[model samples]
Target: MSLAIKPGKADLHWLLGAMLLAMALHFSHFPLWTSALIVLFMAWRLLLQWRQWAMPRLWLLLPITLLGVAGIYLQYRTLFGRDASVALLALMLSLKLMESSTRRDYVILIFAGYFLTVTAFLFDQSLWVGGYLLLPVFGLTACLVGISYPHGVLSNRLRSRLSLTLLLQAAPLMLMLFLLFPRIPGPLWGVPQDAYRAMSGLNDHMQPGDISELSLSGAVAFRVQFQGEIPAQRQLYWRGPVLWQFDGRGWHMAGNDHAVEKLEGLGEAVSYTMTLEPHNRRWLLMLDVPHILPAGTFLTSERQVLAPMPVRTRMRYNGSSHTQYHLAAGLGSRELARALQLPPGGNPRSRALAMAWQRELQTPERIINAALTMFRSQGFFYTLTPPQLGDDAIDDFLFSSKRGFCEHYASSFAYLMRAAGIPARIVTGYQGGETNPVGQYLIVRQSDAHAWVEVWLASRGWVRLDPTAAVAPSRVDSGINTALTDNTLLPILARQDHAWLRKLYLNWDAVNNGWNQWVLGYNQQRQLELLSRITGTTANWQQLMLWLTGSLLLMALLLCALLFRRKRMPIDPAQALYLRYLAKLSRRGIQAGAGEGPLSIQQRAGKLLPQHEAEIARITRLYLALRYGPHAEPHAEPHAERKTMAELRSLIERLDC
Candidate 1:
């Protein structure tokens, strides 16, 4: 007993499985080499168990453990933040497996497994990720239960049932606490900024390849659930960042837009509730030409939605937009100059062509038409992988390659309008979105990212135009899948193209949308709304506390009643006699266990009191006969029971500790 006993074999297996599942949660967070290191360590631990090898000695484990710590520190350059701490936790878990032997070690490993599950949540709080982590949580609990059993004795089915039973029993208490907890606004203050880097979103810059690169991803940018008719696919122009300055290479939002001008409505306004996913950016995308802004957001001069701060979590807000609206009927000298300014010398051929058209056409509208006609008739093809342009990008695209995506089309078109003596700028945002029929909501993905041109005229301050739409209108209607003749550039989900698969995608996305709305998007606003709904009036802290306290008291009373009822259930006659015998022994200075049977008590008393051996032995034999040694008739054991009772009373009165 000097050395701590090794954990049960079944417990080791369960613990190993739980650790691997926890590791899987972080697969995307770590580099391939780090993930490989974790997997190798896990496999080595499993091999040790299979070979029945002894736990690694402290001399070997300590250095390896230190090496893991050093590796994590070097990889992250610090061990003090969210990502580094999670990596350290993962490393410790793998190393701890190598030295796990005693029940205390097993307990520590299981708790580490729980901590790892929570770390996964620290990065992603989506419904599926949360649901997926529950498996490891159940496994860790079952492993703890299995550790209490003899080696190799616990069954998987029994372990699963017991762990699940425990979770089910604890669910009510968990839910009660969740509902009664204080509702706090804003983020929890611990979400890692690094964890959100891989998720792509629109920035304030629009380079040649920016939109094309975004089109490669199919992840949902946001979802729109309309109160009335959903906008047409071709009309679903959700505006985001606006770029006015072109520095010969890219379009950016710097040094152009100064003060935001309020856009006036000319038509009916469309109302919708937008569920925007966290992209760590401030722009709150809205349907093209919004007249009224959602709460907590303002309209930029360039007609872009701007939030007060970066969005770090899922958010839902109500907004009203105008599908057909006139913005800026007139522009100031400063605004006009900003729109018309261009780089000194790039795309000379494109600039020359635009000037020639303007001189010949004699009007802005005609010039626009002429430019559109050229793109439509001239053998210019629409593609994603446009050839790399040189210094004269517009010249190469217009006169040579003649192939590009939305950024190419938008950038070149804006340059043409400016060269034609017309004021114009580049507007970057998402275009069309697929409508999920199941939930009747719009799913706008990254692949829908687009850039269009905005031109100015004396009659109309600014006009929206998509030269890419003129060349490939299907991109606006049927989406990028049908727009590009070469299907290889489509996103993975769009490439599948099977009806059932599409249905499955939409259905699953609908389920996720529901989870996002009710769970991830449940903020302080929603909490107050729920309370108001429940009480049929506006709710306050006093009402919330009263309700919470009353519910908690009711739960406590029910639990107490159940426990008391169980305690009052009947006990067997032999057990009753044994309890009395133990009580009598305690009074005489000798005592049996609280749960000991007459036979076991007799054996212990006989060793200490051989003078009463005859009485003790007789009582033990009669009790065994009456309790377990059965008779055929109902009253056959009555005489034996009477003898056992008399003998037990005589033996107990004479026993001593």
Candidate 2:
């Protein structure tokens, strides 16, 4: 068998590590059965190595491959989508370990590991994930190098060093390609409908207890880095879905028939850049009324910024918003009716209280204040775990329970406003964020998920109101940690006062934001900017390509010079004199025969040149001793090597004279 098929034990170890890491990346995505099969195949391959057992025959392997394919089909009901295809690829690669017959098979496994590393990007593009992916790539390439090594027993450290050197040499070309490549706006082919999963965040619909469920998650929703002065704590409402129509039990987006007006751009615009985490939803959570819409997204008539498709990866966008804005200068009759519409029979007591307030106050603004006052004075408390509500959820929350998160407060407040014949609705979005000093940016977590009410008045147009704010003012200024009675539910970053943890969190976020900006956010626009800066001109795609080609050429020449460069050998005075003495003997008609020993050569030289016999014999002994004596190894006493070399030099000099 060729060296290709006769795998080295070291190469097998390297391949095992690479395969295990690649499989680990897909841990959460794979089913238990699929993971088990891949692991079992790996273990069987290890056993073959350990016990010197022969690999299974092709007949047995072929049926096992078929079974694996059938199993995937049964598990996912298809073999073509992202999830199914990745799982199948992993299984085949792991099985290849057992079928290893030659060096070519090992090469295939190494490359397959690289391909698997790329698949990880389809799920998560965060900095940590990108860094983690480098390990498997490095390991697989090292294995590829180790298998081809002509020497025996290569150390993992040597293999790793060589692989790192290869990657470093290739990095410039890779960087050039990345910088010059044209980025298309969307995928060219169709994607699987279930390729990505929806995450926890505000949706178009919300029930009484919906927002509280999000509070349990500490995962990041988005990050904001302000260009100028950061917006005030109260003004940092990252608005998302606007729900106008309220069913008796829940709130949802407005119907198509309602011609409701959206908030208009008004005062000074605050410019900021936002890096949003993927929620597999179209809505881009912007501050209350976007002043300038991002390039790819469009503003809905109801004032929500939406992308053309679901964001299945990290998205960075530039936005400007005016905190002071006129929301709906005038409301259409149909929109007013929908906002005020409510189920007639349920929550009678809550509706009656709203009616009494409307009768006494005679203005929508005053009625809003009255409801807020009641929320503050009526023993209302904020809690993540609220009591379950029955048929009359609003009445139970307002009169009996009075303990709930923002959703309950916002939901009941909007219901009361409608009951009093006011145009009211609920706005679901993130409320506050923790500031990171290292990055000087704001991090909004899922725990910051909040719901508030907006009511339309005759004079002020539509006004923003938060009944939750009335009960827990700390929620708006200091964030959810202070607002909650049980701060244990808060995320570590939010509650930890330790200096080390705080520093670590901020530093990590800073690095992550930098990666997101330079890597994942690298698009055609950024490419153009980079090219223009490098060429010192207004560079186009053509110029970018030209520069990229030139850079690659330069890198190629440097690599060639390093690879073929010759090393200079140090001069040895003793060896030079010995060569001269041999030349003298050749001139005097005496020479050493092919395969003749050094002692034989010396004896012949002594017979031919009688005048230099003593010097020749002494020189011969010194030469033999220096080259093949007790001090032959360099580690023998340094002083003895110096002494032998000196004596050989003196004997050769006297003979020449």
Candidate 3:
């Protein structure tokens, strides 16, 4: 317990294991050099022990510690943020092992390892990560057991069992706290600004290959659970940002919301709940023409659902959207101008063709059909790896290159519409999702990222037109995989060739979804709902606290009762081993009489079983030492009794009557 008390060899070994496991958990977050440095420090401490080398001097250790701190500061620009602070702790903890010659130092390292284990949750609260961290936790607990059993009365295997038992015993209390404790409003893993690192998703602007680039990643963007049957692939247009202004090469948003003159739902609304991954953006991707918005979210003038705050964490929200709807019947002059705006003096050939269509077909509807006809009949190819475009990207796709992803077709089509006097804008969002048969939920990944065009019409108000569909109808009807011939760029999960692999992935995802919903997603509102279901009424904070206290007290009383009802004296392990040996010998007609010593029994048994005489003698000697020698004394060497008992048990197992 005191600083002067050095940890025994067993304790040191367990401490080393605990430290290494804890540091390995954060390898992904640490810089390569930082990871290497910590590894070196750990290796040095291990060598110092294994080779019996002297510990580094204070003067040398001080400089190394300062250098590590300086390195962390240089890597992160400050030694205070989440990453930097964790890096510092890992370095110091590993360095601490070098001078950990006392029990107090070893204890500090074990506690620090536990702290580091908890930090892993801050980065990822996934079910697998949470489960994996239990290894390091178990290792640290074993270190505590080693320290507690300094005399080594318990073997290593026994200590491991005790450590696991301790963890199992606390599971009920942990569950109680998780269920009844007051819940926080936001994400449990939310931390400082530095912790909200940039995530990959749709940006507000679309360059030539923005959507195509995003399509390469198969990471889940959001998941949808519907009240009834899931929507068809072609109808599942999860709307995101709408871009109105085009600055020559790329499409950008209008950077403001406009008031819709009129809005109406044309069909039955589809009720669904969305679990969106953090994308650090204000836009909440939802189905087209949402009628019921979740709290803290509103529909913009362009019909894009916007959250009040950027989604910096996983969010679950209930939403209802009409697949068919009358969106924005009228547009203000500013909105109209913005929608039709195009860059000056570019793609004259494309502009000329659009004017010809405008002259030939005087209606917006006719012009739209003409554009679709051109894309369908032209040698336009749908692909993930689009060739580079010139400054006039629209013209390059329409007349020159004629090969690009959804962004290319949509951008050129929108440009053609504006030239033909139709107010068309680009709408970028996910186009389709794969239904997880296990959970019966739709998982929309980034590979489903798509771009289409929306043009205003006098009769229909605003109509959605996907030019990519004209070139690659399979994209809308099936998925991105079917739309492209060279599906090599697509992620394996996004492909359809491996049905068995897909099913396996879906089964695992279903389990993860449950973990997310019931564990990480357990917030204040969920807690209250659960309480109402349990108590048949809404339980407030006071009632919850009372229930928690009563349950804890009841558990304590039960434990006390079990403790007091136990036998006064526990059975000796050495005696148990000897009893087993005697029982085996009795099968050979050799039984020990009352008050017979092990020496007399060994002499008689050895003569009768000459073939196993050596084994019988060894077992007897071990049993005698464990039961009657110095090891039998209460204050004798702690390991002597355990070692002898183990040897006797081993010999007894191999003995022939």
lDDT by residue for model 3 (106-164), tens: 77788889998888877777899988888889989988877766554456798899999
What candidate 3 gets wrong by more than 4 Å, as runs, is: 150-154, 563-565, 571-627, 630-657
List ranges where model 2 is wrong by over 4 Å. Answer: 1-5, 151-157, 187-191, 255-266, 496-499, 569-654
Give model 1's clash tally: 3
Residues 375-408 of candidate 2: C-alpha lDDT, one tens digit per residue? 9998999998889998999999999999999999
Query: What TM-score, over all chains together, does every model reach?
Result: 0.85, 0.88, 0.87
Model 2 accuracy (lDDT, Cα): 0.83
Candidate 1: list runs displaced more than 4 Å: 1-6, 46-52, 80-82, 148-158, 255-257, 567-657
Rank order by lDDT, top first?
A: 3, 2, 1
Instruction: Name the best candidate (by lDDT).
Output: 3
Clashing pairs in 3: none
Candidate 2 pairs with clashing backbones: 4-102, 4-103, 5-101, 5-102, 5-103
lDDT winner between 2 and 3, please give it. 3
The digit string of per-residue lDDT tens for model 1 on 288-403 reads 88767787787777777888888877779988888776778878889888888898887778888988988899899999998888889998888989889998888888889989
Ranking by TM-score: 2, 3, 1
Q: What is candidate 3's TM-score against the reference?
A: 0.87
